[model samples]
Target: MPFGGKARWGVRSTVALLAAITGLFLAPATVPATAASAKQSSAAKALAGKYVPVMMIRKQGENLCDTKVEQYQVMTVDALFGNPDVRLMRNNGSSKSTLIKQAPTIDDVRNRGEEAYIDLPGDPLGDTCVYSKDFTRMKNEGEAPVAVYAHIAREKGHSGIALQYWFYWYFNQFN
Candidate 1:
C-alpha cells in the first residue's frame, strides 16, 4: 500500500469533511419571507403614480451637427412605455422635447439626434432607482443609444430612498 491503507483512508475522510463544511458556508442565503414581502410592498408604493419623461432635448456644447437648432430631441423609456406615474426630470441645459411625439427606432434616433438625456430623480432624504438593459443584450443587438430610468424610493424600514435604474431598451443609437 502506497502511504499505508489506514493513512490513505484517513486523508480521504479529512478531505470529505472539509468539503462538507465548505459547502455549508457557500450555500445560498435565504431572506425571511416576511422581510421580502415588506420590501416588495415598499418598492411598489414608491413607484406608484410617478411621471417620468419620455422625450429629452440636450444642448449641443461643442459637437458639430447639421441641425440649425442647438438642441436635439431623443426618445426615452418613459416615452416608449407611456408610464404616467414617474415624472420626467431635467437639468440646467436639458428639458422635455416637443419634437419627438412618439417612440423612435434606433435608426430614427441616429438619423435625427445626437444624444438623449434623462435626468435621474434626486431626493435628499430618499434613494433613487435606475434601470437599463443588460450589456450582453445590448451588444448582441447592435450599437445604439439606449435609455434607462430610475426611481427615488424608500426601502422598508429605511428613511432614505433607494436608487434603482430599470432596464428598458436593448439598443439606442446615437451618432
Candidate 2:
C-alpha cells in the first residue's frame, strides 16, 4: 500500500529532489562524447553522497506518548530486504507476502518500482515503544548507514542528461 501520511519528504534528508531540479540547469543541453564519458565518471556517483540529506530527528515528548522513536534512518535497499526479519510484502488486496529471492537486487528494484516494501516485523499500528525498540535492534544488527540508487538516464539521442537518485528507508514513520 502507499505509505499513507507517514512517509516524509523533508529538506534534511532529501537532496535527490533538489539536485534533480538543479541538474536541469547545470546539465548541458547536449552531452558530447567526452562529456558523456565524464558524466559516467565517479563524479556523478560522488555527487549523490554530497547531496544526501542531513536528517534531523525531533525528541519525543517527556511522556514519550507524543511520538514513537525519533530516529529516522536511510539504509541501503539491500540491507533492509536482506535482513531475515524484513519481509518483502506485495501491495495488494491479500496480505500474503511473497518470498523474494534473497531480497531484490538494485536491478530488481529498477524493474519493480513501488511493487513491494521491506516490512519490519510488528504491526504498522503497534505501540510506539515496541516500534522504537525494534528500530533500535534493527539498526544495531548492522543495517547500512545509507544508500542511494543513482540512475543516469539512457535515452538514445536524448538532449540533456537526467541524473536521479532513489533512496530506500527502513520505515516511513510520519510521526
Candidate 3:
C-alpha cells in the first residue's frame, strides 16, 4: 500500500540494498596497504615515547570582562617539570581557576620526548574552550604550529593518523 504503487520492492527494501552496497565500498580494508598507510604506520612507530602538556591563557589584546587576571611569563618544559622554581597556584573562587605562569610554544611541544598535558580555560559565560590539533596546514604548506604537536603525538605512539574537517567562525552572535 506504501507509495500507492504496484512496485515489486518496497521503499525500505530499496534503501537497505543501497546502504549495504555503500558500506561495502566505504569501509576500510586491512589487505594491500597503500603508500600513505605505510608512511602513517612508520610515523606512529617513531613517536612512541614522548608526551606534551599545554595550557591556554589569554593572549594580549583580548577582552577579559574587567576581571583581575594574572599574566604568566613564558615557560619551557625544563623550567616547569625539571626545575622547582615555579609552582602552581590555585584560586578558591567559584571558577576554581588555576594560574599558569607561562604558555608553551609549538616548538616546545614538538621537542618534548615524554608525556604531556594540555589545559584550556573556561570562557566567561562558563562555556569550556575545546582544543584540537590538525595536520591540514602541514599537509598543504609543509608546516603549522598545531601540526607539530599532532606529528609528535603520532611519533610517540600517543595517537593514530586520522583525517578531520573543521569549520571555524569569527563570532557566534546567536549563541
Candidate lDDT scores, in order, read 0.32, 0.50, 0.28
Over 4 Å off, model 3: 1-41, 45-76, 94-147, 151-175
**Candidate 2 runs further than 4 Å off:** 1-39, 49-54, 59-69, 95-115
Best by TM-score: 2
Per-candidate clash tally:
34, 1, 12
**Candidate 2: 10-residue stretch with minimal lDDT:** 1-10
For candidate 1, the lDDT comes to: 0.32
What 10-residue stretch in candidate 3 is worst by lDDT?
A: 11-20
Using lDDT as the yardstick, the better of models 1 and 2 is 2
Q: What TM-score fits each model? A: 0.21, 0.54, 0.19
In candidate 2, which residue pairs get closer than 3 Å at backbone N, Cα or C atoms, i.e. clash? Answer: 13-53
lDDT of 2 by residue, 1-175 (tens): 0011112445333222222224322454374436554454445555554544345567444443345645445655455544556555567657666755444454444456576655566775756555555655656776544444555554556676666666665566673
Off by over 4 Å in 1: 1-50, 56-64, 67-141, 153-175
**Candidate 1 worst ten-residue window by lDDT:** 12-21
User: For model 3, how does the per-residue alpha-carbon lDDT over 64-174 read when each residue is reduced to its tens digit?
Assistant: 222233122121123223223333334445556454433554444443333333333323243321211111212234322121112221224445433222222212223
Q: What's the CA RMSD for each of the models?
A: 23.5, 9.0, 19.3
